[model samples]
Target chain A: MTIKNRSRITVFILSFLVWLALTHIGDIQEVIAGLIVAFIVSMIAGKFLITTEKSEHIVKRFFSAIIYLFKFLWEMVKANFHVAYIVLNPNLPIKPGIVKIKTDLTKDSAITVLTNSITLTPGTLTVDVNPETKEIYIHWIDVLSTDVEENTKLIGGRFEKLLTEVFE
Target chain B: MIRVIGMAFILIGITFDFFGVLGLVRLPDVYNRLQAATKCVTFGSAGILFGVFILQGFNNFGFKALIGIAFIFLTSPVSAHAIARASHRSGIPLTKETVVDQYQEDNELKDN
Candidate 1:
């Protein structure tokens, strides 16, 4: 099958799975309806759903994505505490600033995930992305370090690492 | 026991939401407020839904709660990013205490 056809099949299966999750397999009627809806949805929106070409290691990517989700949740919890501490402190101790960091990941989707992860994590919010240079500008609540490499490690390093495994 | 734990989670979620609102009122600038409010509230809501998941336990209601958690996680940051970008681009200046303004510098470089 051509890549386009393969992507449509992938979208179809995904939408059907989402349907199952939503309905929880109520009855044979629900299953039949889900199949039809998923088929129509895939045929209409399949191409837009997945931007990248098929990766060779689908199993590896799937596992990596699951691991990434758990890690992301943990990071998010820690981030709340960190923000809470800042909010509660009388001095408020925040040295907010915009800093630049670069990423090597080329795919649009990969870069997007990296950006979203940074925004949700501790003391950082993504402000702008330079498409030409692959550099991301972040508004950091606490300016821990001025050095680009140090700040990059402090902010985007961990997410970028796992994201590379899943997306690259 | 599970229901008790679920109640605890919901309480924690409410506490986080309170802090998020506190941060919204206390922080200095738009960006700072967005930082506190978005993170805490997103996690707060997710915590509440997760507690529902625990209370319901794999039934239809519980599964939908899990899906809601995923939806919140995926979408909140994107909206936060959009607001921050628009605020910065529209000449919303950072606070005096802000240490750096690299985005402004980059804009200047591009203009020149």
Candidate 2:
């Protein structure tokens, strides 16, 4: 079967299995319930989530997204320590500042993920995102430089690249 | 026997947690350190919490443990991203051991 068909089939099977486990229904009943629910959800998903423009890019996008997510998870683990050390130290040796970071990403979902990710760590908050300018304003617990160019390059640049690999 | 098993898992989990702490202190860079903290603490805490849950015999405490695990998974990644971005923006230079900086071209375009 084609990948698309297989993905759908896999989704069906998985949903059926999850339903069985979650509801503790018999197999036949599980299949019926799962299929009906899956069909309804898929229809809603197609209507609300999938666009014709995206449909063509869906397969390539999905795989790439998974790769990005794994990389992102790794980065997340790393950041936790950075924040932890910052927290544990008595000096509270943070140089806090607000900076504007410019990026190439304009996709809504990706931008949201990027912004939310920024907000999750200990020392930073994503205060604003501007798509028209493709920029984000971040409040960093430490601001080592006032140079706009340097700050922009540091904040959004690396993430924009990784996120590009992941989402765009 | 059950108590022994519970103790074993909790200690194993706590050991992992300490390893995560050590990783936080010792890893050479921001990226590497996060790796140690996220995976180690996640599994460690979950292991300990699950041990507690099992020991408690699936009471409300068990439910809370599961929820705690879920919360850790969700929040950990986002927080890490935030810290990294903040560091970079603050001009906290990455270790010399590091190389690539991808957002340069894109940033240039926005400035213009």
Candidate 3:
């Protein structure tokens, strides 16, 4: 089969799985309805839904992405606690500033994941992306360091490595 | 035991949300407020939903709660990013304590 056909099928399967998980209906009619809906929706939107070029080791990448998700969640929990600590403190110690950092990931999906992960974490917000230069401007509450290399390693180090593993 | 655990989760979630509100009111600017709002709502609501899931067990209610958690996880940051970018571009200056303004420098370079 062509790559396009494969992607369409993949989208259909994914949407159908989502439908199943969301509805959780055992009725035959509901399941049939879900299948038809998922197929039609996938046919209409599949091409736009997936942007990543097809690569080898699809199964391995998929599993690794799941592991990456758990790691991301752990980071998120830690971030929440950190923010809570700062907010609850009497001094409200924050040194808000915007800092520039570089990202090497070229794929749109990888860059997106990196930014979203940063935004979701506590005390940091992704303000803008220089698409041409692949530089991200982040608003950091703590302003740990002003140096680009230090901030890059501090902000994007862990998540970037895992995302590259998943997407690249 | 299950009830106790669920109630504990709910209480903790409420506390986090309260702190989030406090931060929102106390923070100096839009960006900081967005940070407080997004992280707090995401974690707080997710925590509450989790508590509901635990309280409901693996039934329909529990499953729906899980879906709610997933939706919040996916969408909160995107919305926060959108608000932050919009405010920044529309000329929301950083607080006086801001140490660096790289975004402004980048814009100036582009303009030149």
Which parts of model 1 are misplaced by more than 4 Å? A23-40
How well does candidate 2 score on lDDT at residue A114? Answer: 76
Supply candidate 1's per-residue lDDT for B104: 94
Tell me the TM-score of each prediction against the true structure: 0.90, 0.50, 0.89
What is the clash count for each candidate, in the order shown?
0, 8, 0
For model 3, state the Cα shift of residue A145 in Å.
2.0
- Model 2: how far residue B47 lies from native, Å: 7.8
Question: What residue pairs are clashing in model 2?
Answer: A77-B34, A78-B34, A78-B35, A95-A142, A95-A143, A96-A141, A120-B79, A121-B79
Candidate 2 displacement at residue B68 in angstroms:
10
**Runs off by more than 4 Å, candidate 3:** A24-40, A52-54, A58-63
Q: Name the best candidate (by DockQ).
A: 1
- What lDDT does candidate 1 reach at residue A148? 80
Better of 1 and 3 by TM-score: 1
Interface RMSD of 1: 1.4
Candidate 2 per-residue lDDT, tens place, A53-133, comes to 424465776777777667655655555555556545666455544566766776787787777555543344564556787
What's the ranking of the predictions by lDDT, best on top? Answer: 1, 3, 2
User: Of the candidates shown, which would achieve the greatest TM-score relative to the real structure?
Assistant: 1
lDDT of model 3, residue A100: 95
